[model samples]
Target: MPVIVAASALLFSSASLAHQLKSSVTTVLFNKRTHNIELMHRFYLHDTEHAIEHIVGKQADMLNSKSDQLQFADYVAQHVAIKTPESESIKLKNVGFEVDGKFFWVYQEAPMPAEPLSGLQMSHGALQELWPTQVNMVNIEGQGKVRTVYFDQQNQWHTVTF
Candidate 1:
């Protein structure tokens, strides 16, 4: 009876929820004063650690290791991209990264549009290779409006107009 109970406990353990969902959320803000678009991406720390280990072959305890945090920032910068309304690519400058308990945050910035503020295209390609079910949600906040967009393997890019 004890053995049966132990087996059941192991089968339905909390460890099973390690990779239950692969998702991240990002918020983009247009800084009119700085003429830059600031980005903040929030992710589950556990999932991000696993992903870093898979990609870089090192478990990055983001809170403890500066190099690991930099690596994560680089990884995020590579996977995500921005484009102007005219289809020209915009360079995203990675500001930094931080660990807040169970969540990890990455900071980024890009040059604001030189012309009128019509629309912008953003592509979020993080974790798609490692996790097939990965979905990234991005929120754009500017001009007294907010919009949400989802990014998956199939739908990676979204053009948001304000």
Candidate 2:
């Protein structure tokens, strides 16, 4: 019917204008087998492409450009931090990054810090500089109960005791 066709057109138009979630998820997990702390970060591919263009001051081909992806991975590493209870930096080595489906992933790993992860300080500011509304959620696992922390424009750092 004419009414059904009009409704379908409206829905398709609205969907085209819908924005992405503007969020990223990072998970910090302790590997029991390797005794290492592994960090995995996932960001919406669309967001990353725009962000890279904004930072690079030119159009970026994130999907096909390996160097661009690696550059973004390095930028992410510089923006995040993890420190011990004693305020010692827990250096996380950049493992790698890759685009998988609709998501871009970055990986980092380091030897698990001395046990009893108490007063661990963490920060994630990957894309917040560009998008004020962006939210980065970090989930800590392999530490008894999974704890979650959210970082945004206002709250950049968090201390977690486990």
Using lDDT as the measure, the top candidate is 2
Please identify model 1 stretches exceeding 4 Å from their true place.
1-19
- Clashing pairs in model 2, backbone N/Cα/C closer than 3 A: none
lDDT of 1: 0.87
Error of 2 at 38 (Å): 0.5
Off by over 4 Å in 2: 1-18
TM-score against native, each model: 0.85, 0.88
lDDT of 2 by residue, 9-35 (tens): 999888775565588999999889889
Q: What is the C-alpha lDDT of each candidate?
A: 0.87, 0.89
Clash-forming residue pairs, model 1: none
lDDT of 1 by residue, 1-162 (tens): 999999989877856765587899999999888888999999888878888889899656767888877787788889999887778888898888899988999999988867866888999999898998999999998756799999999998899887
